[model samples]
Target: MSAEVDRGNLRSRIGMGDVLVVMVGRVGEAALVTGECEGWNIARTVGRVSLAEAAPVNPEWLATWLNSSYARQWCLSRAKATTLQVTLNLAALRELPVPVPPLPQAREFLRLMAVMEEKAQVDADIVRTVPAVADAWFRAETAGGWLPTSRFGELVRIGGGSRMRPHPEGAQPGPAGYAGPSVPVVAPADILQSELAHLARTGTEQEAAADVPLCPPGSLLVAVREDGVRVVVNDVAVALGRGVLVLEPESEDDRYWLLHAIRCHAADLASTAQGAGGREISHRAFAAAAVPWPPVDVRARFAEVAGRLHRRARTAAEEVGTLAALREVLLDEFLAGGSRTSRGSSPAHGPSVRGEGVQESLFGMR
Candidate 1:
């Protein structure tokens, strides 16, 4: 502990450069810590203590400890909260503990986590490129103008989902009954919280008739619901906060184009929209929005280019999922002191398992 922190002291206070924090309640379903300016300040708020301090240990060691599944379980059991909900209070945050390794070992630990972080970064970099590529193909090549000057409603079509009676508790577990041609009924929570944006269509005939909205295969789904200060338009597993629009392209040729535009303008939409409880955008708002559509020939050119880029993005994403699993395996091998270490092999070069089963990508809407 240092000397008394002066309330009026600017240096002692954290705002600009301190980590952009993820409170305990918001971490899992919300996002992982989003970094503050220039990206050096990403951090999480844990209950009972600053995880960086409690172990009297290397911050890297602390990072690995906090990231472990076991630690998540422990945090779940005693997550800090008030009457409204559980939250990590700063005073409580200081109480957590970590395993202190020798300084040298701690250095190694940081090195390994850094590698994992880098792989994760690489995966993200690939995903970020998808939009730019899509834009070049759809907007610039096809429409001839790839500028933000066009509003989404003018460029794409947005639609509402079906409204069912306020769903009753324990009526059933999931998509019940025959869900015909439509995809399964996915919850707002699932879409808003997921890291992946693409969702496989699934459900029974009855479910289709009852709750699930029958969004055509090519149409992107939008949530009209409100959460906190914003409305959410969700795609690619990220929620466009309230008043954010979801575009379902008018034709197959236009789908990726709309997704690209919506992604490009998400923040701007959120900022410009206004409402009391949640930011509001009416159907009129969408119908009246304008876009920079060039000529029909250009639109056709963009479609071909974007389709190729999208396919590449999809393939890269598939590989990234495999890498994420590999990273996890490496984490386990190091933590358990794997048997292969005695065979003259590095622990970092853990054996890889070929992905055999059909598995869900962790990056999308549920």
Candidate 2:
């Protein structure tokens, strides 16, 4: 960031529609084009906009730059002092710098993105049919094959638990001094995952220090407060935070199978929300939410397959996590103009125009 790019009275002097508010991020972290905005406030904030006349020459690459690993890392580095919580700065953000690649290079990036886009559309096709496979297995088994039927509420107790306070200042700093309730505090984002549940362990001393909620042992932690759909958290070692529901299913089969079932019905969960303003999800809404309950034998049968899906899903997630770690490693190398990837690939995943920014999906865990 430099002083010449600084416009001291620039914000207050701008007129309405004098600029376009440009938002930048991978599709996951940002929303754009909700509408146009322009003003002094717009110029001062990350989400605000102004006219094309304001400064258009070096702007064409803004979105791509934001999408770039170098740029994304820069934004993230500037976000906060801590690693766990995200905190973006407004003033520092507007002062940030970007490398303006020539138009030809920018077009090459776009062309590469288009190719990755088509391949990804194929990957997305599997996303649509997996649920039906589980649903049909349930139906066929409950109707005649192996499993029996019961009301969903009969098999599990679904309850929304203690309300959560947003992390007071960001990620809790360091060790909580002692180790009594070291089980991690969690959130919906934490459990939107596959494999073992992870929460940052709060010291029992910390719980005594700060009065935290207990995570249920057999509960399937679910994110219940979104408009029509929600995503599971991508990280482990986090707890079921606010805006989540915990399901304590009766049977071992339920433990093994309920996660898939809920994901199948994820849309319904979102639909039932009383989203008048901020997201509002109730225990009653989730408990009353139904699923196709098949007999025990049918559940056993479904579990046989779902167990495999769950295992494969877990492995896939682990692999992606490994790739993400690798992406970070290679990003550091390539961005420094290193000759090759640590993994031996010619060009690594992040720096080049690869990855559509959607996290690769894995069947979430219970």
Give RMSD to native, each candidate: 10.8, 11.4
Model 1 root-mean-square deviation: 10.8
Judge candidate 2 against the unseen true structure and give its global Cα lDDT, from 0 to 1: 0.46
Any runs in candidate 2 off by more than 4 Å, and if so which?
1-70, 76-94, 99-136, 139-149, 163-169, 172-184, 188-213, 216-218, 225-238, 250-252, 260-292, 339-366
lDDT of 2 by residue, 1-366 (tens): 223333444433333332222222221132122224332232322343221433322233444345445555556666654445455554444544544334564566556545554554443443334445655664454454344334457678765545453463344433357434334565554444322322223221113234444545656666644444343312322344567666676665876567666665677767656556436566666666666666577667677885565454445445544544544454445334455554433233223322212112111111
Q: Which run of 10 residues does model 2 get worst, by summed lDDT?
A: 357-366
What's the CA RMSD of model 2 in angstroms?
11.4
What are the lDDT figures for the candidates, one per model? 0.44, 0.46
Give candidate 1 misplaced runs (Cα > 4 Å): 1-21, 28-56, 80-86, 90-97, 100-109, 136-158, 162-209, 222-247, 261-278, 292-296, 315-320, 339-366
Summarize candidate 1's per-residue lDDT along 1-366 as a digit string, tens digits.
Answer: 223323223232332212222344543221232234222222233211122222244334444655554444445455655644455444333343434445675587668767767877776776657656665544344354454455656666565443332222112233545534422444444344433345442111122344443444555554333432112222222212223344566775666555555445455434333457443555565556565555556556666777676666666667677765665565556645553333223233322222112121111111
Supply every candidate's count of residue pairs whose N, Cα or C atoms clash at under 3 angstroms. Answer: 36, 40
